[model samples]
Target: MTVSTATGPLRPRVRFTGLARLSPRAGVVASASLIFILVMSLVLPAVTGYGPDQFVDLPYQAPSLAHPFGTDGFGRDVMVRTFAASRVDYLIPLLIVAISVIIGCVVGVAVTLIGGFAEWIMMRVTDAIIAFPFLILILALVVVFGQTVNVPFLPNGTIPIIVAVVLTGWAYYARLARSQTLSLREMDYITAARIMGYSTARIVFRHITPKVLGASVSYAIGDLIVVMGLIASLSLFGAGIAPPTAEWGQMMFEGRSVLDQYWWVTVFPLLFIIVSAVSLAAIAERLVARLEGRTQ
Candidate 1:
């Protein structure tokens, strides 16, 4: 309440902290979308009862209630194949983000903590990697590696793409983490830790690392969908996972040849990619917004 002698009623000052500052609408939509994506990508695919390679009908049949996505040239259900592709499509990006974050954070944190020539060298290396057009490098690596690599355990295309993407992917997060860490170095507590003669490892790990990692990891979550798109796009150039694997890009590539005559083959997979991408992207976009809000 305003003081009785006050000239006018005082307005309530808004505090931008915690939940109050975040958008309820965005939070709700993101939660629902995450649940939907998890269910569709993980749960529904398991229960579909059609293997991506199984023959289900005559080749090139039109879409119907039974086969919602129609039959492909090999008589496989296109819808089932699209769902099956989730293992390849989603998993690669998930692994990429997780691996990148781990490798990047270690390198980033070390370089920032070390200082001097070590830091200078690593930063230059990361900068050089980052300076390249990201997509071009990853694609180039994938194409080159796909030809020469032969491993009994890994699929032909998977190994090459993973190597290519990871080679370039971690550098981005390393740079980002370094930038975040540089700011932390100037903070009073970090300076005090140095003045107090705290061990480098102890000070960085105990005080500074937590603060640096939270932001990097949160931002990494938003980067997931972008990585997924890049992996999917690989199939467009016939450089992704080979046939019989049920990847979305491969499906789209094959379907494109017959798109005019048999539209469902191409349309359904495209629709799946669009719907899933949009859904996952909604979550990513909101998270990034909230993160920006935190910084501000």
Candidate 2:
């Protein structure tokens, strides 16, 4: 006679209730803000009917019926430029986040799965990159690369900024992914898969990647907010997108000298930047809560 044992349904070792819950009101507000920004970015350009660089009136003109945001130092329409710059402001951060996340995830997962020498090498390199001050690294890269590289579809001067931001940004995602993967690799399911003779590549791609991507995606949303500020700061300091491009940072930089007299020049762009960053950050927080299974 032989004895048999029964197995029960698997349960998680740790419940995420504390980490996952987010306020419903906050979620609603964040969603609404993001939607408003997205709509404004798409709609304002067409409705305004003023070219960003087009001179609508004399310089230093304050907000009025014709030029709602007033004219800048160069007589360009601040309202039009502000709206036009929305496209770049939104686009650059998004592209940077996407590129960085993808590269980081791939590298992180690969190093974790391969382990040993590869893991050591990638982590060291990532650490070294991270050790540098973020702003200085970006500025250095921008200076070395020069700010005029043009890609087929992107704006003429945006390539350098994109490159620098992506380079500096990916390390965070990589570290996040690696840490998540490390914990996930020891899970019962992963061990079961390994015991079942599944190939390493199949296990890594099919099982491991999904579990690790959740946190990375959430972090990327928050990272977008930081990247937006960085881009604006770069432009404000004379190393961002060039003139006539209508980027918010460049606009603020150009208007700084005349800020005392023509407040609209810098204020409007600064307002938009703040709104966009805060809205995106709120959304990211909600997403993190949701991803971690928090509910109120």
Candidate 3:
């Protein structure tokens, strides 16, 4: 007796184009490094015994195996303080960046949906905000709100600073989104959709939003570094992160007094700030190229 076994059908094969097959090598490396640094920032605090303000060494000690990054003017372990400080410093820019994107996207979509004199007025308002020096804008807000205020969620005043940054930062994204929308609004496809009786809301959210997001996302990534720098500058100037926080900017400020002795105190924080900023910008550069559909 001859018996034949039944077999299941095979799955479809997947293929990739040249561009899709190749990955952004530089961006991947930069992103990986940044992620590693962020993770270390969290985990390092656990193994260390000293806190940011808990001094444990002779003041102004240079780099040693016991201290690693050495002791600051207050005799605090630099490594421990840096790790502890990461929680605040890192989160501030991350929060600001996220808030900025949300505000920008909303304002951009709104300006596009409602055009004419209203759009002009809103655009001008955005321009006015953007025209102010970034640090000056932040300082102005910090002074008015007393640097820290109670928020519905977060107990710390950092939320207030994040809100202020977001408020002023969205203008550029709005302008960019509006320009792209203006060009897209007059497209033949949009005209067809309009003629087909599609609702304005549907067109804006369903069709326009996705297309404009590419530009806005690219813009937001680039803007984050600028925001972080402004935050650091404010912290250095005593307009940000109140006492007891081991922020990089505050560290820099503290280092200024002991520059002749404890260079590591200042150097390490500056190095951290620079590395974080550069890694982000490097990734952003690759992303911008990808978003614009450009090749090597």
User: Model 2: number of clashes?
Assistant: 2
Q: Please, what is the TM-score per model?
A: 0.79, 0.85, 0.83
Better of 2 and 3 by TM-score: 2
Give Cα-based local distance difference scores for all models.
Answer: 0.68, 0.74, 0.69
- Write model 3 residue lDDT over 123-231, tens digit each, in one string: 7777677665666655676677764576653424465467667777776666666777778888898899889999877888788878877666655666667766766
Lowest lDDT sum, 10 consecutive residues, model 3, at 1-10
| RMSD of each predicted structure | 10.2, 9.1, 13.3
lDDT for each residue of candidate 2 in 239-291, tens digit (9 for 90 to 100)? 78877888888888988888888889999999998777766666666676677
Off by over 4 Å in 2: 1-23
Encode model 1's per-residue lDDT on 215-234: one tens digit a residue.
66545655566677776677
Q: Where does the lowest 10-residue lDDT sum fall in candidate 1?
A: 1-10
Q: Cα lDDT for residue 214, model 1?
A: 75
Span of 10 residues, lowest total lDDT, candidate 2:
1-10
